[model samples]
Target: MSFRMIAQERPGNPWFSWDYVQGNSDTILAALREHAALTAQAVLIATVVAIPLAVLAYWVRPLTGPILALSGALYTIPSLALFAFIAPYLGTGTSTVLVGLVVYALLLIIRNTLAGLNQVPPEVRDAARGMGYGRLAQLLRIELPLALPGILTGVRLATVSTVALTTVGVLVGHGGLGQLILGGFRNNFFRAEIMTGTLLCVLLALVLDLLLAGAERLLTPWSRRRAEAG
Candidate 1:
């Protein structure tokens, strides 16, 4: 084969390439947007579902064991296996991945929520009661606010976890950046493509975690003040 043919046949697959990034900017951005959207949706739904369940488990002590067990069990399931199991019923799309992500998130959020609620000092509850705060009022105004930090911690963890797990959604054609990673492997181990996807996933997780941390600081300014005082 001529030199030109040989070069064309075995194109370079550099580990990092700004040229490749510029060429595929649209595709990369689209995948990133989808990844962010899926992670946010999954975490939001999980939080909504988890808070109520945590409250219910908190009040009805007997139900706590079962609820925690079920969520923990769901978390224990392998991500790929869980996706495969759901795909048969959900038909392999964003829905399947969303459901799986929500399932995976429940354990952390629920556990943290319950922990936060339980951490509310008995004296604090008594003080609220002394102020004529009804059960519902105390829970909403005092307990939930006090628990916000812990709940946000759980959310932060779940968000990071979901970002990584979202890549698994590629099995269902909704893997977002995962598509690039898989494509890289399939297309003769294109390092740039693989690195782009991998690095983006890591960056997304870091950015989300930092944002949540900032939110926690904003929402629980007292905690920051207390830390400074201590």
Candidate 2:
């Protein structure tokens, strides 16, 4: 599909003519919502997998190479090809799309998590250990808290990327804003829908990125306060 906006540009037609935009309000909203939902689901799933794997990789140095290699390998696969390979066994629908997106997300999230955890100062960990904190306790209370900044950086990337990629879900019969893009292209109509959907996708990614940044600030307030004092 062409995925072009206002390709014909009729004499009466204009980009984002109010009438077309208003008429397609429902569809635009629905697609926007579905796109958000799928992206969130995929990112959430990836986070669950990535965070723990990162910890494992850090704890077991031997696993680091293989874990990163695996995530990198999965991420290297073309989205459509990965979908084609998995869809047969997983069957069609949103589940397959979710899986593909999660796979796509793995590398960023995993690498970031590992980076964050490793960046925790050894002195801080030693202090925790001296204070009688066990491995798990020190990790949860000290390491992870300090690592929030970098880990959330990965989350911001994953969330934004997932939003962009979710458009591909339309091909597998999963509804997302991408469908409107394709719809507009295939029929050479609904240019407004395409424009609206495309903008909304960008808006969604921006919104999610901002939200995650806010979360990082809240979660790592100590760093901000420390920097201010310094």
Candidate 3:
């Protein structure tokens, strides 16, 4: 029922046992690898799909309502139910997890993308047009670069969220840190496994978030300059 060992004279109770961890390095490490891969894969797919939807939502007035509404609705779906619904069609496994994670990310990515684009000063677009830039040229040259911070912000959030949700994805046979947590629960809350999975999940999210933020800072030198000045 428990993975902890309590010595009669040592302590009243132990939260987790390091000795158990020593024997389970393979399982823990393997789950960590799978968890990282699953999270990264989901984020990449979501970004690819969300970018165009975000652009459409920004440029096309009529489609904005439907686009945002669709993404928002999808975001509201229970992750487990969505995974279950798609597993039958996707036939389970990684494909099903990918579809579910991508759909869940859409609302965040699309909304942030639109906000980023909208934040671009109207004068900047006007000036680009004044300089003989076409709509596409304006978007490519003036808007997208400026909007990187916001788009990347969404990407950061979606990536971290995907990591957390991957634990749920274990239901349909997608292995990750979540699988470890599920295993712990099945084994009457095995403390070492549960703690390892939980800590690894947090560690992974923090590392990924910092990496994204670092990338954003590198790409947006102007923001860094502003920070330095103020």
Candidate 4:
């Protein structure tokens, strides 16, 4: 049976319909793939950039204010405006969306990284120094490990936020599931398409959060042990 036939039979719009899912499985999956890819790319790039910036800020007192201020300023820009502004230079599509998502992610990740590093007790640094661990070694072995929980928490938050904001990329033709959502509204309020996109986005966020939580547990076994003991 055709989609038109199915729609004619239904007459009234329903929130969901197996016919829609069956008819548009390929398109839906493609959009899902695009959304997931864009989100992952944005977050990964943000993490890479944020870590270095966070580390620099932590070590350089003067840079702390500027780095944080810049990130905060970027965060304040509305998603739609930011994408629109970048579209002229970037020429729309995935790059514009990717850049905007990365900008949005930076503040959260940077702040969390700073918080994590600061929470590392002074005595731990002293002990590492006493053990002849150099600045880099101390950071890698002691400070970063201790700071993992806070850092991972920030990543989890940033990732979830990115997933939601990714929908906004539809304005530039790269909104992943957002495309479906917009399409639904444009095509006479097709509830099935809208619901599928919305539900999948929520599902993606939850799944990513759970995966990150598992990673945090794996990486910070000592924290888990302490919690268990407590």
User: After TM-score superposition, what is the CA distance of residue 17 in candidate 1 from its true location, in Å?
Assistant: 0.7
TM-score of each: 0.95, 0.93, 0.91, 0.94
RMSD of each: 3.5, 2.5, 3.3, 4.0
**Model 4: residue 224 alpha-carbon error in angstroms:** 0.7
Model 2 lDDT per residue over 10-123, tens place = 445445667877887887778887888899888999999999999999999999999999999888889989889878988888899899999988899999999999998889
Candidate 3 lDDT, 126-224, residue by residue in tens = 888889998898888899999998999999989888888888888887758888887876765565677778888999999999999999989999999
Global lDDT of each model? 0.93, 0.86, 0.84, 0.92
Residue-wise C-alpha lDDT for candidate 1, range 1-98, written one tens digit per residue: 57445434666757889998999999999999999999999999999999999999998999999999999888889999999899999997899999
Worst 10 residues of 4 by lDDT: 1-10
Give the Cα error of residue 145 in candidate 4, in Å: 1.2
Clashes of 3: 0
Predicted candidate 3: what Cα RMSD to the true structure? 3.3
Task: Pull out the clashing pairs in model 2.
Answer: none
TM-score of 1: 0.95
> Distance (Å) between predicted and true CA of 34, model 3?
1.3
Residue pairs clashing in model 3 are none
